[model samples]
Target: MDPYIRIEHLTRTYVRGTNEIHALNDVSVEIADGEFVALMGPSGSGKTTLLNIVAGIDHATSGAVSIGDQDVLAMSDARKAAWRTRNVGYVFQFYNLMPMLTAYENVELPLLVLPLTRAQRREHAQAALEAVSILTRRDHYPKQLSGGEQQRVAIARAIVTDAKVLVADEPTGNLDAESEQEIMTLLKRLNKELGKTMLMVTHDSAAAAFADRTIRLEKGRLNTKTPETAGA
Candidate 1:
C-alpha cells in the first residue's frame, strides 16, 4: 500500500545573515496509516522542522509532502491552512493555552473556524476533554491547573477537531517523570485505539519507547540507524 504520509527529498534552507542554514537536508520517509513514530535527535536535527512542514505550518525549501490523498506542498496558502485545521493536530513542548479561557473554551477555539453549530462544537470539545481525562476540569482556567492537567487540556484542544494526524514536539518535555509517563500512555492509547497516526519528536528514550518505531536525525539529516521498537 502507498504510504499514508509521504515526504520525499525534503530540504529546508534559510539564509541567516551571510550564511545559509540547512534545517532539513534531502530527507525522505513514509509513514503507515496508523503507525506511531518517534523522532529523536540532538538539537538542530530537523525533527521539529519536519513536523512543522508536515503540519503545514511551514513550507519546505524544496520537497513534496503528501498526506493520504492530499498533496500538502501543492496547496495554496489558504487551502493548506484549511486542510491543516481539519487534518492536523499539533501538540507543543509548552502547553499553549489561553490564560483567560476555560479548558472547554480553549478546545472550542479551533471549531470556531468551522461551520459547526454551538452544540456540535460543545460535543466535540467535550469528547476531546473526556478522551484526555480532563473533562471534569473543563471549566477551569489554564493557570488553575497543574502542568500535567494543562498539558492534558492542550492535547484535548488538539484532538477536538478530530484530526487524523497528530504532530507533537517534545510533548513530555515540560512534565515530571510520572506526568510524562501518563501523557505518553495517553498518546499511545490515542494512536492504538483511535487510529490517529502520530509523529512525535522527543529526546527522551523512555518516551520514544512508547512508539512503534523510532527515527533518529543528525545535523538535519536522516540518521538511518533507527532502532526497532514496540508500543508500551
Candidate 2:
C-alpha cells in the first residue's frame, strides 16, 4: 500500500543577516496509514520544523511533501490551508486552547468552518471528548481543568475535524507521569483503533518508546541508525 505521508529531500532554511540556518536538511520519511512514529532529538534538531512542514503550517525551501496523492509543496497557499483543515490535526505542547471557551466549545471551534450543522458539530465534539474520557468535563473552561484534562480536550479538538493525520509536538511535555501515560495510551488508541496516522515529536525516552518506530535527528539530518539498529 502507498504510504499515507511522504517527504522527499525536505529542507528548510532561514536567513538572519548573512548567516543561514538549516532547520531541516534533506529529511525524507514515509509514514504508512495507522502507524505511530516518534521524532526524537534535542533542541534545534528540526523535529518541530518537520512537523510544521508536514502539517502545511510551514514550507520547505526545497524538496517535496505529499500527503496521500496531493503534493503539499505544490499546493497554492489557499489550497494548502484548506487541505490542512481537512487532512491534518495538530496537537501542540502548549495545549493552545482558547482561554475563554469551554472544553466543548474549544472542540466545536474547528467544526464551525465545516458545513456541518450545529447539532452535528455538537454530536461530533461530544463524541471526541468521550473518546478521551473527558466528556463530563466539557462544560469546564480551560483554566478550570487540570493539565491532563486540558491536553485531552486539545486532543479532542484535533480529532473533532476527522483529520486523517495527527501531528503532535511535545504532546506530553507539560503533563505529569500518569497524565503522560494516559495521553500516550490515547494516542496509541487513535493510531491502532481509530486508524489515524500519528507523527509525534518528543524528548521523553519513555514516550518515544510507545511509537512503533523512532527516528532521530542531528544537525537537522536524519540519523544513520534505525531504532532497531540503535537498540542492537
Candidate 3:
C-alpha cells in the first residue's frame, strides 16, 4: 500500500543573527495509513517541528512533505490551509479549547469551514463527542470539566472534521496518570477501530506504548535505537 504520509530530505532551519539553527536535517520517514507512530526525543530534538511541518502549520526550509499523494510543501498558503482543514486534525499539549465555548460548541468550530449546514455540523460534532465517550459533558465548559474530560473534548473537536490524519503533541502531558491512561486508550481506539493515521509526540514512555512504532530523534537527526517492544 502507498504510504499515507511521506517526507523526503526534509530540512527546516531558523536563522538567528549570524547563526543558523537546524531544527530538522535530512530527515525522511513514511507513515502508512492507519499506523500509530510515536515521535520520542528530548527537548529541542525537532519532534514538534516535524509535526508542524507535516500538519502544514509550518514549512520546511528545504525538501518535500507529501500527505498521501499531494505535495504539501508545494501548495500555496491558502491551499495548504484548506487542505489542513479537510485532511488533518491537531491535538495540543494544552487543551486549546475556547474557554467561553461549551464542549459541543468547541467541537463544532472546525466544521464551520466546511460547506455543511449548522444542523449537519451539530450532528457531526455530536457524533465525534459520542465517539470519544464524552457526549455527557457536551454542555460543560472547559473549566467545568476535569482535565481528562477537557482533553476528550479536544480530541472530539480534532476528529469532528473526520480528518484522515491526527497529529497530537504531548496529548497526555497535562493530565494525571489515570487521565493519561484514559486519553491513551481513546487514541489507541481511534487508530485501531477507526483506522485513523496517527502521529504523536510524547515524553511519556507508557504513552508511547500505545503506538505501533517509536522513533527517537537527537539534535535534529533520527536517533539510531534498536527496536524494542512498544512498552519496553
Candidate 4:
C-alpha cells in the first residue's frame, strides 16, 4: 500500500542576518496508515519543523509532501488551512484548551468551521469526548480538570473533526510520570484501536515506546531506526 504520508527531500531554511540555517535537510520519510511513529532529537534538530510541515502550518523551503494522493506542499495557504481543518489534528506539549470554555464547548470549536448545525456539532463533540473517555467531564472547564484530564480533553478536541492523522509535538512534556503513562496508553489505543495515524515528537524514550516505530534526527537529517533497534 502507498504511504499515508510521504515527505521527500524536505528542506527548510531560515535567514538570520547574513547566516542561513537549515532546519530540515533533505529529510525523507514515510508513515503508513494506522501506524504510530515517534520522532526524537535534540532541540533545534527539526523535529517540530517536520511536524509543522506535515500539518501544513509551515511551508517547506523545497520538497514534496504528500498525504494520500494530495500534494500538501503545493497547496495555497488558504487551501492548506482548509485541508488542515479537515485532515489534520495537532496536539501541543501544552494543552491549548480554552480556559473559559467547557470541555464539550472546546471540542465543538473545530466543527463550528464546518457546515454542521449546533445540534450536529454537539453530537460530534459529545462523541469525541466519549472516544477519549472524558464524556463525564464534558461540562467541566479546563482549570477544573487535572493535567491528565485536560490533555484528554485536548485530544478529544483534536479528534472531534474526525481527522485521519494526528501530529503531536512533545505531548507528554508537561505531565507527571503517572499522567504521562496514562496519556501514552491513550494515544496507543487511539492508533491501534481507532486507526488514527500518529506522528509524535517527544524527548522521552518511555513516551516514544508507545509508538510502533521510532525515528531519530540529528543536524536535521533522518536517522531511521526500528523500535527494537532503537531500544524503544
Candidate 5:
C-alpha cells in the first residue's frame, strides 16, 4: 500500500540579509496511514519546520508534499486554509487554550468554522472531550486544570474536528515526568483506537518511544537510523 503522507525532495529555505538558511534540505519521507511516527532533532534542525509545512501552517520553498491525494505545496493559501480546517489537527507544546474559555468552549472553537449547528458542535466537542477522558473537566478553565489536564484538553480540542491527521509539536514539553507518561499513553491510545495518523515532534526519547517509529533530522537532513522500540 502507498503511504498516507509522501514528501519528496522537500526543501525550505529562507533569505536572511543575503544569507541563505536551509531549514529543510531535500528531505523525503513516507508515513503510512494510521501510523504513529515521531520526529526528533536538536534545536534548529528543521523538525518543527517540517511539521509546520506538513500541517499547512508554513510553505515550502521547493519540492513536493502530498498528503493522501492532495498536493499540499501546490494549494493556494485559501485552499490550504480550507483543507487544514477539514483534515489537519494541531496540538501545540503549550496548551494554547484561551484564557477565558472553558475546556468545552475551547474544544468547540474549531467547529465554528464549519457549517454545523451549535447543537451538533456541542455534541462532537463533548465526544472529543470524552475520548480524552476530560469530560468531567469541561466546565473548568485552563488555569484551574493541572498541566496534564490542560494537555488533555488540548488533545480534546485537536480531535474535536475529527481530522485525518494529528500534528503534535512537543505535546508533553510542559508536563512533569508523570504527566508526560500519561500524555504519551493517551497519544498512543488515540493512534491505535481512533486510527489517527500522528506526526509528533519531541525532544524526549522516552516520549518518542511511544511511537511506532522514530525519524531524526540533522542539519536539516533526514537521517536513517534504527527505529526506537515502542514502549509498553
Candidate 6:
C-alpha cells in the first residue's frame, strides 16, 4: 500500500545576509496511514521546520510533500490554509491555548473558520474534549488548569475539527514527569482508538517509545547509522 504521507528529497534552505542555512537536506520519508511515528533529534535538527512545512504553516525551498492523496507543496497558500484546517491538527509544545478563552471556547476556535452552524461546532468541540477526557474541565481557563490539563485542552482543540493527521511538536515537553506520562498515554490512546496518523517531534526517548517507530534527524539529514527499532 502507498504511504499516507510521502516526502521526496525534501530540502529547506534559508538565506540571511551572505550566509546560507540548510534546515533540511534532501530528506525523504514515508509514514503509513494510522501509524504513530516519532521524530527525534537534537537542537537545530530541522524538526520544527519539517513539521511546519508538512502542516502547511511554512513553505519548503525544494522537493515535494504529499499527505494522503494531496500534493501539499503544490497547493496555493490559500488552498494550503484550507487544507490544513480540514486535514491537519497541530499540537504545540507549550499548549497554545488562549488565556482568556475557556477550554470549550478554545476548542471551538478552529471550527469558526468552517461553514458549520454553532450547534454543529458545539457537537464537534464537545466530542473532541470527550476524546481527550477533558470534558469535565471545559469551562476552565488556561491559567486555571494544570499543565497537563492545559495540554489536554490543546489536544482537544487540535482534533476539534476531526483532522485525520495529528502533528505534535513536543507535546509533553512542558509538563512534569507524571503529567508527561499521562499525556503520552493519552496520545497513545488517540492513535489506537481514533486511528489518527500521528507525527510527533520530541527529544525525549521515553516519549518516542510510545510511537510505533522513530525517525531520527541530525543536522538536517536523516540518521541511517542507527538501525530503526520498535520506536523501529
Q: Backbone clashes per model, in order?
A: 0, 0, 0, 0, 0, 3
Question: In model 5, what is the error at residue 101, expressed in angstroms?
Answer: 1.0
Which wins on TM-score, candidate 3 or candidate 5? 3
What is the lDDT of every predicted structure here?
0.93, 0.91, 0.92, 0.91, 0.92, 0.93
TM-score of each: 0.97, 0.96, 0.97, 0.95, 0.96, 0.98
Report RMSD for candidate 3: 1.3
Evaluated at residue 174, the lDDT of candidate 4 is 97
The alpha-carbon deviation from the true structure for residue 100 of candidate 3, after best TM-score superposition, in angstroms, is 1.1
RMSD of each: 1.1, 1.8, 1.3, 1.7, 1.4, 1.0
- lDDT tens digits by residue: candidate 6, 97-137: 98999999999999999999999999999999999899999
Cα distance off (Å), candidate 3, residue 53: 0.2
lDDT of 1 by residue, 1-232 (tens): 4579999999999888999999999999999999999999999989999999999989999989999999999999999989998999999999999998999999999999999999999999999999999999999999999999999999998888889999999999999999999999999999999999999999999999899888888989998865555646
Best of the two (1, 6) by TM-score: 6
- Candidate 5, residues 64-124, lDDT tens digits: the string is 9999899998999999998997888899999899989999999999899899998999999
Among all windows of ten consecutive residues in candidate 4, which has the lowest summed lDDT?
223-232
The residue-by-residue lDDT of candidate 2 on 63-148, one tens digit each, is: 99998888998988998988898899999998999999999999999888889998999899999999999999989999999999
Clashes of 3: 0
Best by TM-score: 6
Q: Write the per-residue lDDT of candidate 3 for residues 1-232, one digit (tens) a residue.
A: 5788998899999999999999999998888989888999999999999999999999899998998888999999999999998899999999899999999999999999889998899899989999999999999999999999999999999998889899999999999999999999999999889899999999989999999889887989887665634642
Give the TM-score comparing model 6 with the true structure, all chains together: 0.98
Give the residue spans of candidate 4 off by over 4 A.
Answer: 224-232
Clashes of 2: 0
Give per-residue CA lDDT, model 4, range 94-121, as digits (tens).
8999998999899999998899999999
